[model samples]
Target: MSRQFAILGLGYFGSTVARELKRHQNQILGVDRDESRVDALSDMLDHAVIADLTDEKALAELSLETYDAVVIDVDGNLEASVICTLHVKELGAKEIWAKAHSDAHYKLLKRLGADRVIYPEYDAGIRVAESLNYHAMVDFIRLGERQFIVEVETTERLVDNCKSVAKLAIDRDSLFLVAIKRGEEVIQNPSNDTTLQAGDNLVLMGDLDALREIGKQI
Candidate 1:
C-alpha cells in the first residue's frame, strides 16, 4: 500500500529520503524554504513546495497531520530543525523522524516528540569502523545491547576443510546461522547437512561478541 510522507527539508539527506520513498511508490511531498532545492526534486516527488518550515503557520497550511509520516532534516540550522519538529508535533503529525547533528539535537528532538531521530553521519562512521575491524563482515545490524544480526562472507581458509554447515560447529546457545546467500539464491534455516561454498554470504544472528568471533574464523 502507498503511504503519504512529507519531507520538510530538501537538502541532501531529505532529498535522498524523498527519492527513495517515491521509488517505493509512496506519495511524497518535498518541501524546503529554498526554491532551488524544492525545484530540484519537483519531478521526482508527488508534490514539491517551497515553504518555510520554521513557521508553524506555514506547516499547518500543508496539512502535515494528514500525512502518514513527516521527516524533518533541517539540521544545517539547529534552531530551525528544533522548531520544525516542535511545530509538527504540535500539529499532531502521526509520526515524526528528525535528523540530528549532535547528541544535544537528538535529545531536543526526542523531547519535542519526534518518533525517531537519525544520526546519519554517526551511523555511517560506526558501520565503516565495524567493516574495517571485521574484515569478513559485510554488514550488520544492532538488535540491542550486545546483540546483532551480521552478514559475513565465507573465506577460503574457513571453507577449505569445512564443506558443510555441520563442520562449522556454531554454538547454538550464542550463535545461529540464519541463512546462506549464494549469488541470487538464499537458503533459509539451513540444516547442518547444507553444503558450504566459498564466497557465499552467511547471515547470522547472535551476541555481538559471538558474531565477531565467527567473523574472525571466516
Candidate 2:
C-alpha cells in the first residue's frame, strides 16, 4: 500500500530520505524554504513546495494532518526545527520524526511529541565503531536493554570445528541462532542438522556481551 509522507526540509538528510521514500512508491511531499532545493527534487517527489515551515499558517496550508507521517529535518536552524515540530504536533500529524543535533534537541523534540528522534551523525559513528571493533560482525541492531540481533560471518576455524548448527557450542539460554545466509540464499530457523560453511553469515539474537563473545571466537 502507498502511504503519504511530508518532509519539511530539503537539506541533505531530508532530501535523501524523500528520494528513498519516493523510490519505494510512497507519495512524498517535499517542502523547503529554498526554491532551488525544492526544484531539484520536484521531479522525484509527488509534490514539492517552498514554504517557511516555522510559520504555522504556512504549515496549515500543507494539510499535514492528512499525511501518514511527517518528517522534520531543519536541524541547520534549531529554532525553525523546534517551531516546525510544535506546529506539526499541534496539527495532529499521526507520526512525527525529527532530527536532533544534540541531547537537548532530542529531549525537546520528544517533549513536543515527535514519535522518533534521529541522531544521524551519532548513529553513523556508532555503526562505524562497531564494524571496526567486531571483525566478524557484518551488522547488528540494538533491541534496547543490552539485547542485540547481530549478523556475523563464519570463519574457517569455526566451520572446521562445528560441521552443523547444533555442533556449535554456544549458550542456548543466552544466544539463539536466527538464520543462516549463504551467498544469495537465506535459511530461516535452520534445523540443528543444517550444515555450516565457511564465509556464511549467521544471524543470532542474544545479549550484547554474548554476541561480542561469539564475534571474538568466529
Candidate 3:
C-alpha cells in the first residue's frame, strides 16, 4: 500500500530518498529551509514547501502527525537536525528516521525519540573494509556480529576443483553451502554428491572467520 511521508530536508540525502519513494508512488511532502531545495523537488513530490523545520509554529502548520513517516536527513548543521528531529518526535510522528553524521549525533538522535538512526558513512565503511579484507569475496552481507552470507567465485586452479560437495571437508556446524550458481542455473542445497564446476559461484552462510578460512582452501 502507498503511504504518506514527510521529508524534512531536501539536501542530497533527503532528496535522494524522496525521489526513490516517489518512484514507488508514495505520497511525499518535501520540506526545506531553502526555497531552491524545495523547488528542485517540487516537480516530483506530492507537496513541496519551504519551511523552517526547527520552528514549532511552522512545523505545526504542516500537520506532520498525519504522515505515516518523517525522515530527518539534514546533517550540515547537527544542532538544527537535532531540533528538527525533536520537533517531529514531539509532534507525534508515527515513524521517525534520521541520518547521523557521527557517533555523538547517533546517540543524540536516539535519545530524542528517533525510531531509527542511520549512519551511512559508518555502515558503508564496514562493507568496504570487509571486501578489502577478503580479497576472494565478491559480496558480503552481515547477518550478525560474527555471521555473514558471502559470495565467492571459483577458478580451475583452486584446491577443491571438480570435487563433490561432501569432499570439501567443510565444518557443517560453522559453514553451510546454501547454493551454487553456474552461469544461469542455481542449485540450492546441492546434493553431497553434486560436483562443483571450475567457474561456479558459491553462496555460503556461516561464521565470518570460518567462511574466510574456507575461502582460502577453495
Candidate 4:
C-alpha cells in the first residue's frame, strides 16, 4: 500500500511539507481553514479539506485510521493547535507531529499526546546562523546521533587533481567522501583520480573540527 499522510495547515511550512510528500508518492490529505488554500493544494494532494480541525466534531468525522501520519502545522493559533492535537489523540491517530511556536505551546502539545513537536522556525534560524557565522560550513546535515554530514568549501587549494582524497588524508586526517556534486551530476565514491575543483561541492561525513580544517584547505 502507498504511504498516507495528513497535513493540517496551509501556510508556508505546512504547504511545503504537503507538496514534498507528494513528490515521494505518498497519498496526502491537506487541511486548512481557508478554502483558497485547499484549492491551491488540490492539484498536489490526494485530498484537500477546508475545515477547522479544532472543532472536535469536525475532526471526529474523519477516519483517523485512514492516515498513517498526521502533522499539525497551524502555527498562528495556539488554542486551535491544542484542541486539534487533543482531538486527534482522542480519535486514536497513531503518529502525530505538531509544530510549536513557543515553549509553552510545545509543552501543551506534549501533554495532549503529540508524538513529536517540531520548532521549525527556531531550527531554521539556528541553521541560518551557523551557515552565516561559520563560513567554513558550506552545508550541514545531521546524520543520526551526534555525527553530521557537511560540505565545506576549501580555501587553500581552489582545485586539486594532484592526489586522491585518500592520499590527501594520509597527512591531513581523512573525512569520508560521500559524493562529489559537480555541476548537475553527482559522482558517488569518487576515485583517487577525482580532482577537487573550486566550484565543485564535496559531500563529506565527519565531525565539525575536521570539517573546519578541510574548509580552510579548499
Candidate 5:
C-alpha cells in the first residue's frame, strides 16, 4: 500500500521534500503560498494549491485527515510556519514533521504537536564537518555516548588487502562490524571472513573512540 504525504511551503526545502518524496512509493500533495509555485508544481505533484497557510479557515479546508505524513517547511516566515504547524496538528494529520531554523524554533514546533522537528541546514553542516574530518566515512550516526555506527565507503585496500575481520577486531579492537552498504545491496550481519571490495559501503558499529582509532588506521 502507498502512503500519503503533504509538504507545505514551496521554497527550496518544501519543493525538495516534494521531489524526493515522489522518488518513493507514496501519494504527495504540495502546498505553497506562492501562486507561481503552486501553478508550477500542479502538474508535477498529486495535488498543488496556493493558499496562505496562516489563515486558519483556509488551512481547515485542507484534507489533512487523508495524509499519513505532513511536512512543514515554511521558511522565511517564522510566524506562518508556527501557525501552519498548529493548523496541521489540529487537522489531525497522522505524523507531523516540521523543519526548524533554530533550537528555539525546534522546541516551539515540538510543543505545538510536531512529531519530529528537523534542522536540515544544521544537520547538513554537521555532515559536511564530519566528511571534511574523516575521508573514510560517508555518514555517521551517534548511537550512544561511546557507541556509533558509520557508513564508510569500502575500498579495494580494505576489502582485498585488509586482513580478516576477526584479526582486525583483535588487532584494531573494533567491537562490531554490523553490515555492509554495498551501493544498493545491504548485507546485514556480514561475515567476519567476508572480503571488503571497492564500491562497497561498510556499516560498522562500535565504541566511538575505538572506531575513531580504526578509522584513523583506514
Candidate 6:
C-alpha cells in the first residue's frame, strides 16, 4: 500500500527520502521554508508548501494528522528541529521521524515523541568502516546489538571453494546461510547439497563476530 508522508525540510537528506518515496509511488508532501527548495520538489510530491515548520499556526493549517508519517529534517538548527518535532506531535501526526545532529539531539527528539531518530553521518561512518575492514563484505544490515544480515562475495581464496554447503564446516549455531546469489539467479534457503561457485554472492545472517570470522576464514 502507498503511504502518505510529509517531509519538513528539503535539504539533502529530506530531499533524497522524498525522491525515493516518490519513485516507489508513495504520496509525499514536501515542505520547506526556502522557496527554491519547495519549487525544486513541487512537481515530484503530492503537495509542496513553503512555510516555517516551527510555526504552530502554519502547521495547523496543513492538516498534518492526515499524513501517515512526518519527517523533520532541519539539521544544524537544533532548536527549530525540536520545536518542529513537538509541533507535529501536538498536531497528532501518526508517526514522527527526525534527523539528529548529535547524541543530545537524539535524546531530545525521543523525549519530544519522535518515532525514529536518524543519525545519518554516524550511521554512514559505521558502514564505511565496516566495508573498509572487510573487503568481501558487500553490505550488511544490523538486526540487534551483535546480530546482522551480511552480504559476502565468494572468492577462490576461501577454504571451501566450489564445495557443497553441507561440508563447509561453518558453525551453524552462530551462522546461517540464508541465500545464494549467482549472477541473476537467487536461491533462497539453498539446500545443504547446493554448491557454492567462485564469485557467488552469499547472503548470511548471524552474530557479527561470527560473520567476521567467516569472512576471514572464507
Q: Output the number of the lDDT-best candidate.
A: 2
Model 2: worst 10 consecutive residues (lDDT sum): 208-217
- Arranged by TM-score, best first: 1, 2, 6, 5, 4, 3
* Number of backbone collisions per candidate: 0, 0, 0, 5, 1, 0
**lDDT (Cα, tens digit) per residue for candidate 3, span 12-127:** 89999999999999999999999989888888999988988789889989999999999998857899999999988888899999999999999999999999998999988887
Stronger candidate by lDDT (1 vs 6): 1
CA lDDT scores, all candidates in order: 0.90, 0.91, 0.88, 0.79, 0.80, 0.90
Q: Write the per-residue lDDT of candidate 1 for residues 68-163, one digit (tens) a residue.
A: 999999947999999889999999999999999998988999998899999988999999998898888888899999989999899998898679
Task: Judge candidate 1 against the unseen true structure and give its global Cα lDDT, from 0 to 1.
Answer: 0.90
**Residue lDDT tens for model 2, 1-218:** 99999999989999999988988899999999999999999899899989998999999999999999999999477788999999999998999999999888889899989999999878988888988898787888999889999898899999988899988777888999999999999999998999999879999999877787777678
TM-score of each: 0.96, 0.94, 0.83, 0.83, 0.88, 0.93
Collision pairs in model 3: none
Residue 178 CA displacement from its true place in model 4, Å = 2.0
Off by over 4 Å in 4: 143-146, 154-156, 160-164, 167-174
Better of 2 and 5 by lDDT: 2
**Residue 53 of model 2, lDDT score:** 89
Which residue pairs clash in candidate 2? none
Deviation (Å) of 39 in candidate 6: 0.7
lDDT of candidate 4 over 1-218, digit per residue (tens): 57999898888888998989889989998888899989988988888888987887777776765789899988688998898898899888989999999889999999989999999778888788878876656768887655678876544454553345654452234467888887898989888777766567778887666665555565
Better of 1 and 2 by lDDT: 2
**Candidate 1, residue 93: how far the Cα is off, in Å:** 0.3
The TM-score, computed over Cα atoms with residue i paired to residue i, of candidate 5 is 0.88
